[model samples]
Target: MTDRPERDALRPRLSGGLTVEVIETSALGDRSYVASDGEVAVVVDPQRDIDRVLAAAGRLGGRIGLVLETHVHNDYVSGGLELSRLTGADYGVSAKDDPPFPHRALDDGDIIDVSPRLRIRAVATPGHTFHHLSYVLEGSEGPVGVFTGGSLLYGTTGRTDLLGEHHSEELARHQHTSVRKLGDLLPDGAHIWPTHGFGSFCSASPAEGDASTIGEQKSANPAFTLAEHEFVEQTLAGLDAYPAYYAHMGVRNIAGPEPLDLRAPTHADPEELRRRLDGGEWVVDLRSRKAFVKSHLAGTVSLGLDGPMVTWLGWMIDWGAPLTLLGETADEVAEAQRELARIGIDRLAAAATGTPDELAADRAQLTSIPVATFTDLAAAFDSGGSGGGGGSATDGELPAPDVVLDVRTRSEFGDSHVRSAVHVPLYEVTQRAGEVPHGTVWVHCGSGYRAAAAASLLARAGRDVVLIDDSFDNAAEAGVPLES
Candidate 1:
């Protein structure tokens, strides 16, 4: 369970009569806010886990009169529909997205006075998404802050290419104007409350810091300083591929996603796990790469419980597929469960925690994948003795060669990468593995995080593999071919 903090513990204090508390999702570094004036409260851009939002509203000593969303989110499932249904609050989302459920279709410049103490204005900021809105919270002193869903972030705007490349430039240009419009419209003192930041793929680049203020952003943000054309070009150039699951989130939000269920998953025994594994279910192994490589179930894929776990789960796993997990500890399994819930992936069939020996009651032989450092890999490649291949099959037999797979993004691969390395970015590897050829696949990312995930996927598919478990910088240091 997410540590549900008391609303008062958050110390809800801003310039306005509003008492605000930000419920942050650490996995994605996104935030959901409850801004209230003693009488009524409004929830902005909540994650699918509505329990936290409900608790915050109850603490405010007011009824939840409105559940507001700035835009149809791309990163995770939104809690707006479920929150509105439970609280009997008016659901407000941008009309341009054309939501299927009953809602108050919010538009640009629409002011909402929730109570005598609370007021908000919806500003159309169409950079991140074509229908995005930034809600300006009006106070006695003037505008206090704006809930910027994906538009104006702390130091940069949200990414524009998530929708598709065809619309990226157009949205990037709009984002430029949107920031300028915000700068011109809001007071310099307005606080900036953006939902996406802190290493989220939704951001164009680093936020520099999490602090939010109109004055600080105007001086520091690239969108505020660059010319429209320059900003568009720069923003487009900076983007990398976001999670493939993002393509499904916006549509689901519009259609109204099901509420999150945080119930603990059923524990399956070794025999049941083997059945699922044999059935080709995505039996994910959530142990560390070192542990996974040392010994693991033959057909289970490994994706450790670290570094953007939610994004990778969404990107790599087929939607609605039967899912089970094996973790090093119960705590690790619980953490993975919560992360999966954020993306509406709660249909976990079963989960367990055990070692290869403990998990294999049948004494089925556990398999191991080899690991390599960049220094040794470079020498072997140069000597024309590529890496190892031909592993003893545990499930089925397949002939696999030594193929170097660069799991880095296209842009990263373009900037610098190993020569002759086939790039099938980490997110695309599960579905596009056929392009990898029948060989011992050597996988490497900018860092080893993605490479670990890729190597496990290859191993699960019965492909012989070795993980390049080192920094990409080492590739250059070890005299790997330099490409521009």
Candidate 2:
């Protein structure tokens, strides 16, 4: 498993006695904030895991007095309601959002006084979602900062398309107006703490920098710098596909998600594991890509815990389909479980922990995939070996692959990709697997993570596959033909 930094590593002190502790869920690329004023704390946009927030408040020696939600989040399940229930803090949700649970119906211009020195004001942002709110923290002197959840990110705003395509354009316009409103209302020095866009697909475009100020954003942010029409057009045009699991998040948030369950799942023996695979259930291998490529049980897809396993697994799997995890250790499975819970995939059918040999019924159940680099791929092409068809090869030159499947995003593919590579994004690989031509398929992504996952899916489908396990940056340098 990859080494994760402490979640509350970034504790930035704001004006007055208030200090903001950031709880980052890097797997999902979102941050939850715990703003404490020595005695009392207010949490903003918390993830499903509340223990981290509780720990942040504990470090500050404060009581959590308020929990706030910026909107009905489309990315992950919110911990606000349960956090409020656990701490007896008043839960705040936008008045426009009709969540099933009881919460303070926060409206625009509403001020919540946590102490004599610290107060929070709710401002209707209505960009990322129609009911989105940005909370401005006020000190005795003036406004200190704003929690712009999915509204005004570091350089761009959250993608407005999550609501649906029909509403994307309208929401983009709202996003434009909302970000400018925040810029106009806040002071130049006011810090902007956004919840999304630290590599999250929620971002309209790639966000820049870790920290930003209202003044800086005004000059750099599309909403502040571009005309309304231009901003709306640009945002809508830049939109890409988000995780399929997202379709369930908003609904779950609105209905009030079940309390988190992080306990260990039932242990499955090798025979039980085989049964799960035979029943058409998803059995994900939570090992490193290299380990998985070396050996894993057949029919088990590689979604290594070392990468964005939660993101790709949620996107590629059939929602609500039974899932079983195979990890090298209990901790690896536990970590994967915790990440899955963030996106509201709570129940695990079962899990097995051991080496592939320990988990497989026999040697026949074990399999391996050939790992290659971009240079190796280039060499294969140069060798003029016929594999899959449908490649653009000149006379005497080998076709790119039986099929050269580019599993990166459309935007990445459009930027520059190997010549004649088929473009099936990682998210669409499950349904579109048949579309891939018959032959030895060579799959690649920006990095090897998605490629490994795609290769596993192809392998599970009984297709011969070679995993190009190198960075895309080396493609051109390695003499792999590329075109924009």
Candidate 3:
């Protein structure tokens, strides 16, 4: 039972002349890595933070010799290609089936000799994705461990509900075949490392324990215990609603991926940014509401500049439509560009020109407003304030036909809720808001962070919104009736 905190330390062990590293990608999609050899390292499927991987390789004083992806990830953007270009590593993915993207495809029997003792064998495993593969590290002692990717988890395996147009029947069949193959090929004692854990939507039962043995997984994994038909039913049952943005990636990957140049986007200019926006480009400002409210280009939407940029943006932005950036600074603009690249969002026409004011000379092209602080928001809610700059609702008043939008997780919402409140989690608010009756909107989360996101999303979409501003603890303490 290797704990996650220990595995995340990026300590590489010596096997023959090779050094191996294991890094963990946190809930927000940030990753850290390990480097073993002085000039050679292997990078696993990187989350959005490429700097962490690069910094790890730089500290080891070795170039990244190989880039590996265990599967086609759905929960977060895969930064495999970006790190490969940055570290000069050869990218590797399974060659058994044609992947959505191009790479130095490897087969089931393929082996890469990074060093004398460190050879990685690509094992074709097809449950999570038809092309998903796991890499087994053959050390002198025996097979040390395998980067199982989404095929297997700490307690569960990856779900097959993500196969949009692809036949779920065929995909489920492949998944069943894949895990059985993995169970046979991998030694019972072999170490198992997977990408997701608790809080991930990809697996309902992501293990709290980080790495487990193949023997342990066989004993514990629910998917492995079922027959093919039963396994398919179990895998598809009760999957959370996938973000709307996921339906487009398969086609994008089938086309060869174009490398992104971090220097500056070619299409970024004042007129071009406007043209793209006029052309229906979705302007995503990767800055805080404070920064955004201080000044932002007209017709821009704010989603902030961190974690799951690709995942959330993919959910929000249309792929063929153009995009523009409102970053913190010039450096952040570059970070945003790289973040978009992982999801194949390459249609950037230009960046925000000069300053918000300089670009707003036309006046129609600019909009700025005062942002309410959380404290102020809380106060307004206490006094039954409507917060639309209109007037306050009287004490004990529900803003006539007011709809309380619970932005907490479904499980959290199921646990309890305000009276007559509609439940649409922050994740699904963007897609499901059409169902919200045109009336006052009051949003709340376990805390206020997610509620703020929900409110802002509704506000940008031209909905009248307010914040409940209740902490989970306080909401319960106030003796509010919980549904369950």
Ranking by TM-score: 2, 1, 3
Flag clash pairs in model 3. Answer: 39-62, 100-253, 127-175, 267-349, 268-350
Candidate order by decreasing lDDT: 2, 1, 3
Pairs with backbone N, CA or C atoms under 3 Å apart (clashes), candidate 1: 400-439, 401-439, 401-440
Candidate 3: lDDT of 408? 73
lDDT of 3 by residue, 220-281 (tens): 77657888888777666534555565565444444434454456766365666677656656
Task: Point to the candidate with the largest lDDT.
Answer: 2
Residue 2 displacement in candidate 3 (angstroms): 26
For candidate 1, lDDT tens digit of each residue in 164-213?
Answer: 89999999998999988989998888888888876788999877775678
lDDT-superior candidate, 2 or 3 = 2
Q: What local distance difference test score does each model get? A: 0.81, 0.89, 0.63
Each candidate: how many clashes?
A: 3, 1, 5
- Estimate candidate 3's alpha-carbon lDDT, on a 0 to 1 scale: 0.63
Residue 203 of model 3, lDDT score: 63
Q: Which residue pairs in candidate 2 have backbone atoms (N, alpha carbon, C) closer than 3 angstroms, thus clashing?
A: 388-402
User: In terms of TM-score, how similar is model 3 to the real structure?
Assistant: 0.73
